[model samples]
Target chain A: MSGIVIIGAGQAAGQAAASLRQEGFEGTITILGDEDSAPYQRPPLSKQYLSGEVGVDRLLVRPEKFYVDKNIDLKTGTRVGSIAPSEKSVTTTGGDRFEYDKLLIATGSRPRILNITGSDLEGIHYLRTMGDVDGIRESMGSASRICIVGGGYIGLEVAAVARTSGLDVTVLEMEDRILQRVTTPEMSAYYHQLHAGRGVNIMTNTTVSGFQGNGSVSAVLCGDEIIEADLVIVGIGIIPNVELAETAGLKCENGIVVDDHCRSSDPDIYAAGDCTNHPNPLLNRRLRLESVPNAMEQARVASANMLGGDRVYAAIPWFWSDQYELKLQMVGFSSDGDSSVIRGDKSTNEFAVFYLNDGKVVAVDAVNSPREFMVCKQLYGKAVNAPDLANPEFELKSLLN
Target chain B: MPQVKFIEFNGTEHVVDASKGESIMVAATNNLVPGIDADCGGECSCATCHVLIDADWQARLGARSEQEESMLDLNPDRTDESRLSCQIPMTDELDGITVRLPEFQY
Candidate 1:
């Protein structure tokens, strides 16, 4: 057999390679990464790595030796220019062609850059790859005033780190509140206060009209005011890398559309992680989750199906975020109509917000309450009363019973 | 690099040269030590990286945080020595630390 080939060595590609080895597929495996280093975890980049609490070595999903030991070919700093589905082959930027019996697309997502004037300024940056963070870290030392664009998880995380590092951090979100696209108003309000209390100047309903600088960014023109910034970090959002999949004649929506089996439109090709929009059978919907757990889980399922396993990927999706001393662990997807119940005291930084729809526990967002998060994971997709969950006296573990 | 020892559920020991300040979960996963799943990349949200520290090294490992305590409470194999390996950094004091992976983790 020609063996398996994985494109884009992010978390999904890394997990797919590791899973193939674990599943005892000993033929041959190859991972092509455009980054200079091996596949590393991105979660820590905004937190530990950015704050210098951890080094670059700690960010690795697995050490360089793991690939060599598993006899997996890892091509770093290489990009696949195009894919020929007819020949079952892909050509790299350097004109190297490789054929595969099974192909996995995990090209992942890129940070959505701003289209405003002075966006190309040297000081304006986006955090995505190892190199991106490395550049940000270097700039942070000399930057006393930092203006962060967007009020999402990435922006909030960077604000938390910047505040701790004694830098003047200002966050500008076009929306009325931060994380408006992802979380509930209660959760958004909680974080808004959290960052505000920590001395981060958060400006919501604020949009950066343009960047004002000489060669590097010095100020952000928002509304009628110019917010002076020594450095700027844009964390608006990400767009999935689907150009290759589109060029290959595979199905591409906002992301590569995959079935329950994580198989793409092409039988020989499979897609997983951030790049793939797969069905969430549990939610009865299709979601493209840009999370570590989702990426890893989908990759596992994709790898299994590639090895001829008839398993359907129906696991509940969970996500977590760390901001300062608070850790938010969320399970299941919470939609707008889902009525929510607060389970614990929010002031103490230990609380769990349970979102219910039609008397069924649809999702939960737990902060500092790991036990509640764990129970919520077990109770995922099950019907439960909001009053019972809201009642503090009622034991969460009893729901499982 | 500090040498950290990881013993599997079946008593297979793997000694890894862990870099200073990196978590034990990173050390294990980087070195291909099978037992530490660390599904959330050491966010302390996932209990998959749970390990039982040896009595000799318990004091040097520091006190468990409230979040770690709550996470350990959910695990069926919770013990006095059980810890989320991601929370334990590889410092010089933990150079010779030995931990046993729970059977459930494997």
Candidate 2:
């Protein structure tokens, strides 16, 4: 049976396969992944995995034996070269063609490369895959200093790991402050102080002109000033892997354009995860989220729809980051809110920042405050009293009732 | 290795062997037992790995950490026996531990 073929083995691809089986789709399921390893979780690649807290076995979303027992044909190290929509088939770079009754594109995303001089230096790296982290870990053993470009979550996370490993860490951000894109000035300042207090050299409003080294990267050149570094990690951002969809006559915007059902232009073809710019009914807008929750939930929705079930993907986007002892849990888009209220003492390092828009809660950034973060997930678009929200003594659960 | 008994919401039970120091959530996910999402990969950040410890084994499991308690308190389905399975590591004393998966994670 030419049943289902899923491309790109990631959270979405693995989840789609599992959900399909759970939905009792008694058909052939094949997952094609370009990476040699089976479907693994990438979230920990920057934190626990890089810190040696977790091993490769723990990174796997499911055990290797799972695919075997579930009768799934998982093809690893197979890169798809092209897709023929009319024929409903995909050809790999190795010239193998596979036909599918239903095609799921979970191509995910890749790190946006900084194409400046010395970009191809050996010590320069980006943390998007397992192989990349392995390279970084190898370099960290001999290296004493690490310069991370971009002050986003990945950069800050890497910096935390680097500092904890006893390496000199410097974070270079082109923006006025770190985490400028996703968080507010106050939050950015908090993280900046947090990193600085941890002995990390954080440089804001700093731009890296290029890298300077003999063979490997020895320094990051910022105009005339040179920041000495044995290794450099660029976490600028990620670009959606939408070239395959674009070439196949599918709608392509910043990402592969798909409806709420995760269906691309083609009726039989579906897309999920970072690759698809799907619509979120909760947010009332189309967004491409590089989040595990979004990926897994979209996979479930797409899988159910593939099996003739109508499941809408309408989940509030939430994400978390681990930096030392702090666990930052965020829900919804903070940008959607007009004003934000601090729920607890930031000095204690246990507080929740509630972002409200017109008296309705829009988002929340909870640091070491999972109780408030969990309640905030359910408080989206609901009107909340400013005084009650700001009072730490008042339980957030009461607002729900 | 200690044995973990995972009961699904629908009453299907699957017992799997778990190594010492491995969390109950890991044992379930590794054994291909459905229900435990553990989306954060045992970070204790995501409460998707919520499970109810068998009443007989509750006292032996010890109290939940402050973080786990806060996370569990947010769950509407959480009872007194509720615990994030990722926080419970397997040990020789915890052999034959029985836990039930909630009907829904979110």
Candidate 3:
């Protein structure tokens, strides 16, 4: 049997392959990846891995032997050129065609490149894959001053690591504050203070006009101001790799549009991870999430549905980021809430921000507060007293009862 | 290297050698012992690596930290023996410690 053929050997692809085997699918599984290495976790690329606390071996979702022992044919560095959905086959860039009874499109996303003058210069790097991080690590060896363009989670995370590594780090955010797109004003202020206190210079309301250098990047030009830099890292964001899916005649919105079952417009085709804009029944909305938890969970659901089992992907979205010594864990969408109430003491840097709308808890942002974060995860769509949430002595567990 | 015994929900048992200082989750994932997802890669944030330790070896492995306890508290399948495998480092003391994998992570 041609069995199941999965595109993109990422977190979603690895999980889907494992989940299928777990569900007793005794069929051939083939995973196609453009990267030279096997599937690995990307979260640490900006944290421990970049900080040199962990190595590439630990980043693997599963060891190379896993594919061998599980009898999974993982073709690394093989890019699928196009999909002949009608024929149930895919042609790779190398001109090898693989026929499949079932196909899973998990092409994932790519780092959005910064296009401007001198952006093509050497030493300006973007973090997305292992090779990208390896290039940045090599640049860090000879770099003294590093300028980060973008104040998102990635930029701040890389800033934290660079600052801790004793490099002169500066973060330029076009927005008024860092994390403006994903978090509230209070959270943005908290991180701004946190990074500044750690000796990382943060420039808000700043725009990068272009990079300044001949052969290698030496400075970043912001309008008329020149920020001296030995290296430049851009963390603008990512674009979903949906070109293949779109070419295959699959529905494509902001991402590959899929149903609750993670099935695309075609009945036999399924998609997951950063590339799919699936529906969340709990949130009662459709959105694309760029998170490992979402990717893994959706893959599980997609796998089940692929095997003729009914499974809905309605998980409450969650994400975490580690900066300096603080751990920030968030659940649900902060945008769904109208107002937010702070729990615990912000001065001590241990607290939870509960977002509420119409007296119902919609989401939470827990900082160094996993106990409350765990409890908050269960509080989604529940009505709770705001005063009790703000009270430090109030028992959050009682709300469940 | 210390040895770790992982018992799947289906009563299948696999005993593998685990290096000291590495976590039981690492041993399970590295050994290709299914059921331990460890999605967060030992970050303790994702509770996918939840496992129930044998009652006889619970005290030997020591108690879970407050963070670990909080992460475990969310799991409906959690019991007195439940622990995040990522938090339990495989030391010489835990050479023959046995852990049972849960049926589902969530």
What is the lDDT, from 0 to 100, of the residue A355 in candidate 2?
95
Off by over 4 Å in 1: B1-36, B51-63, B76-82, B88-106
Candidate 2, A296: how far from true, in Å? Answer: 0.8
Docking class of 3: medium
Q: Give the DockQ of candidate 3.
A: 0.50
Which model scores highest in TM-score?
2
Per-residue lDDT over A120-220 for candidate 2, one digit per residue giving the tens place of the 0 to 100 score? 88899999999999999999999999999999999999999999999999999999999999999999999999999999999988999999998899999
**Model 2 chain A: lowest-lDDT 10 consecutive positions:** A392-401
In order of TM-score, best first, we have: 2, 3, 1
Residue A133 shift from truth in candidate 3, angstroms: 0.9
TM-score-best of 2 and 3: 2
Residues A1-401, candidate 3: write the lDDT tens digits.
78999999999999899888878898999999999999999999999889999898788887798889888999999999999999999999999999998899999999898888889999999999888999999999999999999999999999999999999999999989899989999999999999999999999999999998989998999999899998999999899999999999999999999999999999889999999998888988899999998898888999999999999898888899999999999988788898889998888999999999899998899999986777777778899999999998887767874
Q: What does candidate 3's lDDT look like per residue over B9-101, in tens digits?
A: 999999998878888998897676888878787899878899998688998877889889988876768799999999988899888888899
How closely does chain A match the true chain A in each prediction, as TM-score? Answer: 0.98, 0.99, 0.99
Candidate 1 reaches a DockQ of: 0.47
Error of 1 at A242 (Å): 0.8
What is the C-alpha lDDT profile of model 1 across A147-215, one tens digit per residue?
Answer: 999999999999999999999999999999999999988899999998999999999999899998899
- Candidate 1, pairs of clashing residues: none
